[model samples]
Target: MGLRPRMAISDIEVIAPHFKRRLSGVTSTVVQLIPKQLEAGVKISTLGPGLPDDLPKLRYRDLLQCWVRPSSGKKRIWHARRNIEMVAGIFLRDVLRMPMKLVFTSAAQRNHTDFTKAMIRRMDGVIATSGRSGAFLEVPHTVVMHGIDTTLFHPPRTNDDLFSASGLPGKYAIGCSGRIRHQKGTDLFVDAMIALLPHYHDWTAIITGRVTAEHEGFHAELEERIAKAGLTDRIVFLGEVDDVKLWYRRFSLFVAPSRNEGFGLTPLEAMASATATVTSDAGAYAEMNVSGSTGMIVPAGDGDALRNAIEPYLADPGRAKRHGENALAHVTTHFEIGGEVKGVSAVYEATLAGER
Candidate 1:
């Protein structure tokens, strides 16, 4: 069940396809879920590139075996999270006449294009990452929220551990991680830091994420703004690191200031790291956060609202600490990776049972 590919063709109950070669959110989700799903007793295997060698996998040539009935006498479930994967699943099932059922998992909250709508209609079972995403689907689907790996994102040993690791001139470190672009609300986080950091000397801001070529101008302008405010030292940028989960540990407070998102995971990751968050109401953020309990939720794309939500944490470090504790407890109770594996397995079970 650990790292070994399920080589026996008859043993595979589910086939998870990742058609894209680039490392994306979908790729990360597949990489994280498959091992946990296998450990949970789901006979699942991945297909395609960009995945680690350890996980259970199948070669492209092995797809020929899909035509043979599984030993269980049930159609193998083909789980897809992207359009290209869905199309490939359709071809395998319809054109090649494979003994398989197509299952599509959608995380997008927007209305589907005509092509996507047609593709979804052919799915034997569909899963949505959040209720908001489910609302956009014209077909019936199960809402299965994303979960984090708590073992990799646990809290630090001491309250000062965040400052100790960073060695920055502050008692607390505020953090935002993801791609640096307007859609991700990098500018909003910077503006909030510029407005609030001067007043709160104990707190410093850290941004960790890649600044892609297209967003270079946007990144430069934010730097200009921070310099003009003369708070460049307080608002630091650590552009794109591999071990972001460690950076999550180095945060007294986390922020996900996206103007738009598709089931944002940073807030959940932050919560699992025992750091309270101030996230905008984008993607499933409102679903993950309990306002004033675990963390605050501001209106998306509103800089003033974002600033107001963050000011409370700066004004009262003790309250932030309490909220961080609450966040940890909430995520541990409801958003562990095991819970996601179980929910997805339920869908596979029902689909295999011939329930639409």
Candidate 2:
């Protein structure tokens, strides 16, 4: 799509807020979803910093115009994905009396805090990312799982030399991407690699994502363990990367061994890249993979189970390739971005009509 003119505040039917300045999973979701939502004819604009310059957005001062209701008789929708944004929505609608309805999307699988529960109770509509997350909510909610852009994440062509250019010594790559922390099970993945890589000499292990100050000790511990195993050369860490999809393309096998999560998307992204996955039963990971056909799923936080689940794929490259193909087909059919846009748009329609 080409650059478009700025939209009038009165023309917007939905305002998605990205309150956080740092790039995160939620920020990525907002960036990916809005363009598709607009393509599907939802009159939406974002309200916050940290978004692309090309995206339709409102100025901070534009909050004053919210008092002027949209051209449609129905109140505009204020879709908040974070607690802070929810508070902002509540203030605008309740205190300032803006003509807007509040909607919050919950992705946390754990029980809600009383503070969070109180704010949720004030929302006009709620959306849960998965059934597991929905089970924790006290109020009524629609289950609308997230999806990825299949066209952007598909397998690399035969002519692609992405791995060779990386200069890493391996014919195949096994990857784990996300924060390097205990909660993300980065140590479990490192342990699995230490146990399995010696048997599979042609494969190399790659870890990507940021390491904040609080987790620097955990990151050091994992690196030290790999060094002690004398596999430091075999297993590599590429800190945080700008082009994650390219790395996904280079991977023949992907792992997501998180001890806990809130509707994880790494497995889906890997699957879309035609990379087979071995993931723990955290968040919506199990729901995304078809176990034997697409990949394997083991109990969360079990090191033995994690290693064993990934062993079969390591033993046979042909088996991994077959499952990777299956993964591509499954994701293309079930988890395309359009499906998510449709589900979310329906909720917006229902909320505006006082039906949700």
Candidate 3:
């Protein structure tokens, strides 16, 4: 059937779907984008489960109405961040004969699976989360790096402060957060902390994340190793936390030593919080760190390199503070969520204009 304008005034112009029940990079992206997009005057809503109830939501039944072309003679944008959501878009746009535009934002920095490639090839448009991720894509795509909420992550007021009022005993805490596994290099962070903290008594290294059932042994081994070094008092494991942004501000230096990632955002979040960052050259971390200029970037999985990168900051807290300021300025200039929203809206407008 030929395309026609949406009949209802309540139709959502853009829909960001959260299909899974778990919190992940995809869900976080969707959650962060909605408020910014809405501020820019886009009639957007999220569908499916797992999203916070605060943001506007469109019921799944409402999705059927979005099958028609939207008002202003434009195609409704259905942005998907995962394989299942992509498949749903295909069903809505191709199988169900919907007039929506199918868009997928890929954050995987590695090669695409044959099945994934097949699904991606059918998208009306593709958005790669980074140039590294784009390089692995077999289809034409736009590169839009994720941005941080600078308002929420901005530097703390003067005076060293306790984070989340948890009374964690350090003037400055160094933290590495994410899923605890070999791929995330949590053990590397542990080893680096064990080697460094005895000398720099003022700073304590902390790791915050969930160790899934499969990685329990790996987590236990790391903890045992930390205990053996008599550094358990210096190296703390907070597990998963809800007030992570608050914790980021308490960190004078934030470490992300992942052996692999898909454009990791923790470093950016740290920078936005005005914290110096040390990251391995996995994902687009090198892009975020700017080497010694903004923060530190080291070789991935090299415990020695990670330790070396952090010592300079530990040795000179003044330098760490200045680096944190530079990081804040850099993120405000280049990585604010406002800029990301603008980029996505530009793509949406172009897609509506029939410029694939």
Candidate 4:
């Protein structure tokens, strides 16, 4: 595929591996085809704790003009210091020589108030991932919805071999993907699964992703709760997988029980794979899921609501299939990767052209 005009995005912290993969995949594909189009470059390259050092290097001319910011001592308080660092970094590294337009992705790694003020004072433009996130910034920022690789996440074309292979043949498999942490509300998902176990015996819950050390105790606690609920035979925890598209294909239903998300992309991926979804009304879930139109949404942190939202689908596969088909159609129409690239490309052009 040919690259559109090049624009650099900051926020190098791989807070989520999937997020990093999407960013790198999208940008690199565009850069490969139209290397010269990337006149405006990205900076602030920070990596995750254990990310490989041999990652491929980007070659846009403006990329050579960029520099990464040094992280501070109190990493948890990094957001509070990020605005100051961003302003200083921009002036010293990007603005001293020439006036190049910038398109900052996330907030300045600081409190919303501080980050908004910093953005207003520093950046030439902004592209927020969701309306709620954009609202907090209170800038002339555009709500640029995230995109998914539909080709990679499309409906399964093969047989249900994986279901039988995982010993779940003839049973519905509900899957949730994300870091197994407190903020993600994996405990809530566990609670819901526990509640549903007595009623639904022909269903399994598959949770995938890595668990943080800070959440080790919580993980243990959840496991004990699952065992107590006698769901050991019903719940499967598959640690991080290289290809999540495969997981989505195998799942009959996808659940996003997160407490907060800037803009949940997992549901979009699942929808693309033609998997019905039940997400908490957290963050951007409402915008992504149309209640009964695309998929169902339950109140955040409410295990009962989550369980109820999922029970109907578990009882009726035909309705679930209809919801999944609708979801796939809805996401395809609204969140195509080409549209995302075009929209972002427009932002870059307008920014560079100084078209407020």
Best by TM-score: 2
Better of 1 and 2 by TM-score: 2
TM-score of 2: 0.97
Candidate 4 lDDT (Cα, whole model)? 0.64
RMSD of each: 1.8, 1.5, 4.5, 7.9
Q: Where is model 2 more than 4 Å wrong at Cα?
A: 1-5
TM-score for every candidate vs. truth? Answer: 0.95, 0.97, 0.93, 0.77
The sequence of per-residue lDDT tens digits that candidate 1 reaches over residues 97-157 is 9988989999998999999999999999999999999999999889899988887778986
Q: How well is each residue in 1-356 modelled by candidate 4, as lDDT tens digits?
A: 33232223232211111123323223332322122222223222322222233332323343333344213211110111134434543554355543234456552222476545765556665766667667667568767667666766798787752455566534778889988888788988888888876787777889998887788888999999988877787887887787777888888889999887656678988999888999997767777887886679998788788888988888887777888899899889997666665666566556656654
Tens-place lDDT digits, model 2, residues 1-356: 55566799878989999998887778878988898998899999998989887789898898898898888767889999999999999999999999899999999999999999999999989999998999999999999999999877889775452576678998889999998899999999999999999999989999999999999999999999999999998999999998889998899899999999988899999999999999999999988988999999999999999999999988998888999999999999999999999999888878887876
What is the TM-score ranking, best to worst? Answer: 2, 1, 3, 4
Q: List the residue pairs that clash in candidate 1.
A: none
User: What lDDT is reached at residue 187 by model 2?
Assistant: 95
Clashing pairs in 3: none
Where model 3 places Cα greater than 4 Å from the true spot, the runs are 1-9, 158-166
- Cα error, residue 213 of model 1, in Å, equals 1.8
C-alpha displacement of 44 in model 2, angstroms? 1.1
